[model samples]
Target: MFPGPTGVTTLKSWPESAARLIAVAAGRETADLVVRNGQWVNVHSREVIAGTDIAIADGRIAYCGDDASAMIGENTRVIDAEGRYLVPGLCDAHMHVESGMLTVSEFVRAVLPHGTTSMFVDPHEIANVLGLDGVRLMHDEAVDQPINVFVQMPSCAPSAPGLETTGEELGPDDVEAAMGWPNIIGLGEMMNFPGVASGDPKMLGEIAATQNAGKVVGGHYASPDLGSPFHAYVAGGPADDHEGTREEDAVARVRQGMRAMLRLGSAWYDVKSQITAVTEKGLDPSNFILCTDDCHSGTLVNDGHMDRVVRHAIECGCEPLVAIQMATINTARHFGLERELGSITPGRRADIVITSDLATLPIEMVIARGVVAAEDGQVRVERRAFDYPATARDTVRLGRELVSVDFDIHAPEGADTVRVNVIGVVENQAPTKALTKDLPVRNGLVRSDPTQDICQIALVERHRASGSVTNGFVSGFGYKGACAIASTVAHDSHHMIVVGTSKENMAEAANRLAEVGGGVCVFKDGKEIALVELPIAGLMSDEPAELVAAKAARMVEAMGECGCELNNAYMQHSLLALVVIPELRISDLGIVDVRRFELVDLIVGN
Candidate 1:
């Protein structure tokens, strides 16, 4: 059996593996497999060498050069690449598996055909609901696969300390305990920028534990202000950041001795702006990485995974070789796995992608651990479904059925017209703008104005079944009909967020998610139009990725029927409660002013 360079629980067996790898390369031992006649993309040297043959032994690359006939014995399997471009398998340096709305096994099965062989995932979405045990469940399932899946222990549960509440809270002890687990990479994104800048003991303790274990610490400074606050966050021990959306933001991160990760996910198109740091400003490409911070299953199924991100980077004026380095070796070096599985060289894991073109980059074949895993957009390997425990399912507890009155926002006194603070959604971005709108009040209750595309948004506390509903306002959905969308995938906190133009439809949407344990649903005119039931931790579906992607596509169409014109509006709706990002967001506590990092009044001048 070919063993990948992953799931190495102990470091004692490396010496024996290294001996066999050297003997095979020196023609003293027989090789298991050899890939012939290909253009080897040497990410380490930033060059493409033609007519290269790779010898594999014990699932590790033994040689990469002009000829490997010496090691090819009678039993060796020869794979003729037909002179294709042999690119190293792509890696997503940062992401959330829960954002795909599928389990780890399903996520791997979806991206394997897309040439994604490694992923560094953060389970913070599940951590917000089930705590460390939830993270362990994901980690265990990640290692059982044939590819490399590194788990980053969630550093933030609520994300923000007091501005919002969650189903569970993770502390320094949780971080310290996860450090010793197999496949544990490092700490997840530290979203508590305020806590880090203020020298909060709890936040510092988690960073200290990760550094003591000699692991990487992810950063999330959502603020665009590169002032003293940004410098303070760097001093807090985070080694990289993916929150940057500008060229200057990337420059600042690299200048501060941290890697700047450019992300092109389902909704966030941030690569065009940040990649200019290398294309125009001539910054070193080694300090930059590529990732997909959050991608829905619809994007993964319709579009490619890391292949899509790499193509976008190449289109953004980056050289194909340079962009390949950003996705391969640059990511591996960031996580201290440079010699393990990044490049197609001796001693690295035998993960290869045979592509027909460098610019278009169509993946024709994928080989992981010297075995063919996928070919021509089809997964050929066997993937077993993980049987998630019953405790992980049925997590949506609304306590009681919500009614129209529960979503109504009462005005101050007997006011007829009221000015309220609203969360302004930015197209293809994570940060929201704090905008105020003046609207008519009927029966002393503030209502949504569909003519102006202003809709009412609410956050329902489902963790403890408190039946607490906090209502606010949001703009820019362009929703005109009597429709509502609800989801249990609110980022960082995982609360149920309901956004709609009608109170009755909003109530209907919330009840729909509660009925199916948890998931996303769209309701129009007091009836559910589409839904995707995610029974595991109220975050991921136990079904196949293609099945979840189908339901998500219908949900997107439902948003279109209701007058939403934004691309992937469900992704934007799910992020309305993410309090870690600026400038405004709603939470279980109340409407939070993220810039101020405090709970503020929803009604202005009250």
Candidate 2:
């Protein structure tokens, strides 16, 4: 998600940065920053040059070579790199900060220590829910950061119009307007693969606007087919794609003149499968890029972000130097920012990562435009608080209090068993299976089928509620006891998603989440057990990242107590209403068959 590079401060270029580094060397300047001696991993030429000296002046790279003793000023604060490998700062080619469930500032605080100096972010997450105003909110926040954070206006609002209903929808008009913004690098992912393949007028219009403005257009071809549909979509004008999960997918994208962004996100593990094209197939590495498509806050803190992706590429047999290229220079080239901050060239930003080892990538220190932003795996910069508008904050609009009756699915008169469609949640991925099971009826209400691991799932229309409730079934939570989990952080729309082994618990859980404004809540044995309050957009917490993660972990533990055991149960619950995924999904309207891209009655005709 990128517009112009405003608000978000650009780490001054090496030309300017070099001046500061030179001043530092000449004693005429006590430079803003200086790294004494660090091994330089020059990704541009795929070489691990060692014992390199880097100089910074006024937030830009002034001098970068074997030795900079001549550039050290009397007052220059020098850091002893101790022969660590100095690599260009990592960059995420395409990502959504909201997927981490953290505000832009919080996300920055979490990733800065991991050596991510720049991100080409698509704020479509907010755009879908809050429109252009939401995109501006995130854009302004990124502009205030210490590193490079660029925004891309969302090109697809409902992602797949008519197939889904988001709280707000963006059109080509919004795209044209965003092109004028300083930080807007381009249009966000063009997710409507079908629309592109068919040459849909609206999709074409958005692409035309982006092209007219000379910005890169993102692509998302989620379907596995690499046939005519894929070809048609590729020819439709998207410049890059990250949804590929196979070697062939990678090869095809590169051959077609698109950058293949390999991602290893918190839940989406795609890099390992696709990197084989470069490692074993002898494909050119320049066309390949690295990104974390989605990462929750815990993963950001405990694991890493772009750094994690680089390490994973190494594990997948890519040379460490090539891996760094994918994260830095390759990403920069894809976004048309090759001369800016991608490499350790003379004119680039002073964004470099000092590492002791090249293969393992032990980030010893991180420099952003000559400033010491992180040291020894710790963030050195302070996160600024964005003034969130009250209207944009706590947007859980549940029109009425929920009751057990709202969770009820009536059986046809005298029906012994009712056939219910269930959404099968695949762990670590966003795809769901359209499953059906016969459920027993009691007191005129159909019951949840725990034996099949099927729990009752419902979507509550929190945006203007309208007393609308769409009830469906979801599997994979493995709930065995009287526990129900509810969350207001449903994908895209951020409605309330409730899933439970029991209707009573489901009612309690869903209602409690609504009462809490927004957040994920788990209920076990009737009483409210744990809650993760997300007051920001009913999807993020204003509290510190650790605090939100701790609360989130407690919610997961509560789910475990209720006999629900799944990897990252919160992710599973959050995706229940994601219609773009597949098989089956629930909306404020009713059960939707995503594979068909159409809504259907809950009870399929027998």
Candidate 3:
């Protein structure tokens, strides 16, 4: 990657006559390091120029031009550039580190090789479990890294008030405590969009603390309506948003002076839809930041990080230079790091990536703070392995063994056929529908219609397990073959969600997962098929990312074997309980009508 960058930068600036003369005169002087020649893709100038020599000292680029011979010393390592394009290391504007199911150090190793130097991370998933302590643990790990990893204190614990109950709730006090941490950049995504718009005191207090600290506040306005509520949220001081799934959403955020972060993660292909705001509508790309809100370990190891976003933007008709600007300098500017690491400039961190092709972005080498961290798809420094506390494991408590009677949905007496509301799952999307279906009530028990693919979905309360199980019907999995899937990795609230065609299989799936402390398990004909043990707060596995990815892949294959063929099945499974993102979801209490923001009954049309 270093040689590629040297080649690309040198090719672009070869026309300067005085630079070559100076280089020839002062061949080998004293300097910390020297990359003999390279081509530089300058995001600020929006130009690709070659014949550039980068001089570095004290982890900062002292000079970047064709004539850096005067800066080179006998001890300085001279790396010959074999004509590769040198660009600034990529920056992820918004992301959730835990979403990848990797600890901070593991996530760093996975992405560092891909040339991602800086990240603005939100750990709301863990915060929902362990509150401020969890946030502190993440913050402590971030400050010790070799590269810049900024933490954003999570503002919403349950995500939506009155809709769900998380294990721990973070209020304004917790927000203020995290604000002073060394690595904390600001508040995380304000997932409580309604709270911010409605002037909820607790939400406002957290936002005020972030603003008073002089850090940028994050936003999450997921609703389609861009009306007064949206206006009120802008007034609440969230400086950036990543939930803009449309061009109108992007325009609205930018018009209100918030950076619109377009994402193209493994599960979310939002960039193609919203990049038109800049490429077609001619909106300024400066306020638009590119990010990957959630990426699994597989995508990180196989596909590139910010390079993927830049490629997607270019494919959506954005100019190559414009796309680079969005991923680099534009992102740095949003985080108030414009003068630091976003560009290939003097006094900036000598973090850069060398790629063979800008369009393909085949990353050959990755450098961070003037040291090679990864080369040719390999990590240079050993990544740290964190130990999950004993208390973190074995957190799944079922209270008592579940019985078939627990899944029974009581309806009005003597009703031959009952019309019920079902949480209709949508594949590859966050939203669910309040679907209704009339079913035959036999033996005083509501049975699932396998022909209609309306499988039984249940939320077995894991936190403070009062043995409270909320059962409902959900379609769209296309499950068959007496298989059941259970997971403690439910989003926001982190309850155990079980979906199955057979109650017996469901019980086995749920119990087997509990036996392993906490994890995702699939059962077929009362026998376990696959399980990914997440013993840490019942959220993340302590295993290496590659091992975890393999387990997750097996889980996906198990879902496929069970007659379900949805894209990124585990993602859909994890997000089933995310009340903030959609029309309908299930919680420990009962089914939630997200549109109305109220607790809804499992039995409808009673």
Candidate 4:
């Protein structure tokens, strides 16, 4: 059996064992494992060939041909595929492990059973809280996983420089230093599109460092406009983009020499809309890849991971072979790892998924590095725990106990009503709408109108314990009654974001997270209704995925009880403070007009 965490680094390089692999392929030596009589779903050729036999040695494919009978010996372990489809292990081209609400080890354990053998994770969420130390922690843990877990150096710590503030800032120096790490793949999604287009030194320096290291530069151009700004951003060294929402967005990215990553995350339903670029428009499918940008623990444990994305793509009219290619070889090629993995061809890592069906893609068995990792929807390997240091926990510091008055928004003196800018939540999407509302003032304080589907949103600074609260208005949660939800998982800045219909409930929810180190909690009528403790830098929990999923499911139920009917509304709540996406977002600094890339007053014309 393979030794647990150290097995990853101890795996011999292909060169060190090439002679043995050659001998096995030449039928002069027996293979360590031989899988016979399978229908190879050849992703490279977009074809399925039956009666294929694959021989593995030294954790890499030695030979895949019509027969490996000559390489069989008495000691060789042989598994009869029985005509099962031997598909390449699915790879999530882009994702955030922290968003899963589980530590790296737990996230890997949860997804491995779903046939996700490789993950390209961007730890920007944790970077917002613990800076370089946070990113290093995840990187170290990721390298120890049994499967491929590549870490992308975070490109935007604050996401937007002046629009918000983070616990730490990562500049070009940090990016360059991280590029030398063992598993560092590239710079993460460049959320600062405006900075890149305008030739901002810090953003350009990071891109240059990744390019200099011959690594891929990921992109996040979260704008609908495919005009000059988009073109400028593409030229700024980002080789791929996963923020495209429309068919035109996908088309434009591919046309500009950038790979278009179509995502089907828990809350993001973007695949159906953008997949037409290939199905209808007849663009070459090679430039298109599938990914899940963000998925919570419940989604990973219950629904699926990359397998879910591939099935959804097939449902969107993509052929099974093409969808499988998008999820496998296309992702590997995008990251310049075609020779390492992504296919069942010789010399690649022996990462294969066996399934009886192509369309449904039920993962009957998963083999990673020539070892059985998962089978029958269960992980077969031992679960390894990566202990996070004490410094990574108990990060939530509210400076002082918050009260209902701390959430009050003082109105202009003697004003009965005021027009305010509200952050409008768009269901199943990342961008919010900038909305203006005429809200009444009571006792010289601006009030939330629950009847109008409007509620108060506050960004409480947790990193520095500044006791600073930036309050604003938001709509579209459909929340009723005296309810509030607070999470320290706010994007980019990782501040505590509280959305509530009542000031007292908002205060209670905020204080609840503070009291428990850090996590997400919901409050109704001054009582805690649900909670999920994410004590690791306040972005992820150290617990198992199922336990966290149970808490998350209860939290979702609580949201529904409070009258929020939006699908995956909790995801929407967490992103309310992401200053990089469109329209409006609240931050530690103030209400951010993301379109304008500047801070705007909460009250209009004040």
Which of the two, 1 or 4, has more lDDT? 4
For every model shown, what is its TM-score relative to the native structure?
0.98, 0.94, 0.93, 0.98
lDDT of 1: 0.91
Better of 1 and 2 by TM-score: 1
Q: Which pairs of residues clash in candidate 4, taking residues 3 or more apart in a chain or in different chains?
A: none
Which tens-of-lDDT digit does each residue in 401-421 have in candidate 2?
Answer: 777888888888788888877
Give the number of the best model, judged by lDDT: 4
Cα lDDT, all candidates: 0.91, 0.80, 0.81, 0.92
TM accuracy, model 4: 0.98
| Displacement of the residue 283 alpha carbon in candidate 1, Å | 0.5
Q: Where's the lowest-lDDT run of ten residues in candidate 4?
A: 1-10
* lDDT score of residue 167 within candidate 4: 93
Q: List clashing residue pairs in candidate 1.
A: none
TM-score of 2: 0.94
Clash count, one per candidate: 0, 35, 27, 0
**C-alpha positional error of residue 28 in candidate 1 after TM-score superposition, expressed in Å:** 1.6
Candidate 2 lDDT score relative to the true structure: 0.80
